[model samples]
Target: MKTIKILLSFALTATLFTSCYTEVVVDDFAYVDEPTISLNQLLRSHELWYVDINSTLGYGETPFLQKAFTVSFINGVVYANNNIAGLGANGDGFGIDVGEYNAYENILDVYHDIDGFSTFDVYEIDYNTIELYNPNNDTSYFLDGYQRNNFDYDFVFYDNIHYFLQEYEAWEKTYTSEYGAINEFDNENYLQFLAGGNDSTFRSSQDDTGINANNLYWDYTGVYGVGDVYGDAYLKTLTLDYDYLGNEYFELSVINDGKIELFHPSSETVYEFEGRGYIQYLKSESGTKKEKVQSDKLRKQRKDKVANPRENTRKV
Candidate 1:
């Protein structure tokens, strides 16, 4: 009888071990229809960009249309930014956001920190492609196939101009005219280029009270967004846009960094105000610390090296 009992106990123990092993197997192979992605692991190394809106709910002026999107995951948290022109309904679509995510039961729950936003679900993630349904979206996917940006810099020339202006309240112009008329400039008594949003702001000096000539502040106004172009000019020279009369104009070959060399030649607009002079936005040393400098210098060096080629081959 004792021997029989021992055999039964051994059989029961073996069965229990088999059951535990079966549970682990089921855990890994639990979801069959969709791939089981370890969400935390995948998000750490990869990011997503919007390929296009999903074509399920029919398309006509959807929010994600023609808009850029980038989603990043860091330390179990998510951050996103949209470059939509008029961001979301009532300006809700623009700006940066921090959010959280949880993957459970074959679903991804995204919780945005912005108000008037609802928790969204990600139903499927296929390789680099993703399927999501935003409450704002008429169909699944606020965007699809969000890929990584290995060189993730959303910076444009306009952004650079904005930051440079925001850093300094007043600026000085030291320029050389084509005829050597406006070459001599003083740092203390500088031109009044009051930096305002969306246009060429009124001109003012350090002692200028209002946007006028009480302290030699001219009426150099800019009707912004109408003539602002941010791109490279011919021969890789970065340019800025200025307006004259009812026509649009681009100040080509204007060297604009922290210190600007305003050498664009046009007798009508502000380009010829000093006839090819340099303008420097004066700021506290701490303020202009991070501004990118000497890019034009590097550009010149490359041009010179090409123009006057040199070879370093010694006594061979």
Candidate 2:
């Protein structure tokens, strides 16, 4: 009887072990049906849409649109400011403002205008999902200089400038300078002074030591975004370091008005500011629109002069 009981116990343990070791098989061929309404269809059904930029930045007061032109699905064309029909020929081009990095729950709102009827909705789309649409519709024109190579099928379109403007304003706030030094000098003069200075006191403090007692060093870091509208200008973390007492300090300084908070990593003290005077000064000193136009015309003339010989040779 004891031997029979031992055999039964071993059988039970073996059964438990086999049950524990059972494998779970997932069917890799399982398929899901595509949604009945394509992103384009949804846009055609809605009239007006706006993306919430505030949703991207953890805390902001506005939203931006993915495209800032009136989209005509029937004609398959996009217009900038509703002026000059052709793409790149006479139009301002499509404006897209992607929001900040921290807002994980943010979405792009697309609006559609149908037969004098307008409706809007927000869709959650990301970088990877936007790669499916064909922007190369024969009748469509992308105003922005950068050509779109990848298309995503799931993107919704919106034709609202007001919505885009609101978001642009918010984004502009991020690039403005927030700090400035009271005493600043021109780059050339400052460099010459530093290089030719005979002051033993200044030299003693800053010469070989990493720690300079007479120099006030300021270091700042900021975050930015990236997209086509602001070609090559994507969101980035920027750092600016300057030695206030050095003449070369002004040349190395950077200014922006965007909401910024400065912290002393050693002491953990934070300083926040809304604007910088240095940037304002530089903007004022830059040439006016008329001067810029003249400069551009001259540059084109020079290029044409250089290319004329090549064209003549080709004709021959």
Candidate 3:
């Protein structure tokens, strides 16, 4: 009787283990129907996948996808546009290689250089839209695929203008419209939009700092926000809340890569600021042989130009 009981217990344990293993294998590759195109071909079919950050639905973060505005999969490598300065021109529109990825059955396994391994279940929602669901984090990021020529780089830049403001150490006042009533903003000569720490912090200085970003002194620190103007792709609204000066509002527009124009509705004044101490993030060494060589040369040029910090700064 005891021998029979032992045998039964062992059988039950084995059955449970087999059941769990089978469930895992099935879950990993849930779509049983044979795909018309392999996952590799599907990912590489488009030149870029624009991560719609606002549409993300989950609590957890997925490494590179969370930070990148767009992700590209090509030749088993992963590239991302982590900055807005050179979105359309960087790496011939491929941006920087952040890691390598492998796609099999409907699963994409990425090994990011800094964030390490992550697994995502890919689902095609439509012809241009696809959902990248990270099972580990219970997060889903919807990406709209586009070719290099079709992608609207301007829209992406205006949509994410907040990050662009933080890209420079300081914005020096270069132009202010002759018209409009004089207000407190006229006294503000420089503005600094910072990242981290709540992500909306801004500082203003009345001193003339020129292209020397580090020399600027903060006279007032405040919180600022950028809001979109409905129906207009290029127009945005900015508001700066100061502790002593109350709230200031303006119509913001990107004049160029390093210049921003803010139209103050209250005073009817237009202010243009030039970015100082421009920051460019991440340039990896992985890509095609030619791309790698080009990146190397660019790195050498940057090294030589590092002696003059103002080389990247521009006057409006």
Per-model C-alpha lDDT, please? 0.36, 0.23, 0.79
Top-TM-score structure, candidate number: 3
How far residue 109's Cα lies from its native spot in candidate 2, in Å, is 20
Instruction: Estimate the TM-score of every prediction.
Output: 0.39, 0.19, 0.74
- Per-residue CA lDDT of model 3 for 42-139, tens digit only, reads 89888999987767766667756866888999888898887787779888988888889999988899988766899887888888888887776667
Instruction: Give per-residue lDDT, candidate 3, residue 150.
Output: 95
Q: Candidate 1 residues 1-316, lDDT tens each?
A: 9999999999999999999999988876766635545655555435544424323332222222212244555664554433322112211222233456675543455554432233334544555655454444333433443333332233323333433332333444444344523321211233333333332443323332233223354334433321234453221222222354342332433243334443333432233122112222111244222112211110000011111111212223
Better by lDDT, candidate 2 or 1: 1
lDDT of 2 by residue, 1-316 (tens): 9999999999999998776665322222232333445555543342222222112211111111222232322123222222111222222233211111111122212222211212222232432122111111111111111122221111211121112111111111122133443222111110000101121111111122233223423222122111122222222222222334422211111122233333323333334323211111001122221111111110000011111111111111
At residue 65, give the lDDT of candidate 3.
80
Scored by Cα lDDT, where does model 2 land? 0.23
Model 3 earns a TM-score of 0.74
Which stretches of model 1 miss by more than 4 angstroms? 1-32, 38-42, 48-69, 81-97, 123-126, 136-149, 152-244, 251-316
Point out where model 2 deviates above 4 Å.
1-238, 241-258, 275-316
List clash counts for every candidate, in order.
9, 29, 0
Model 1, residue 224: C-alpha shift (Å): 4.6
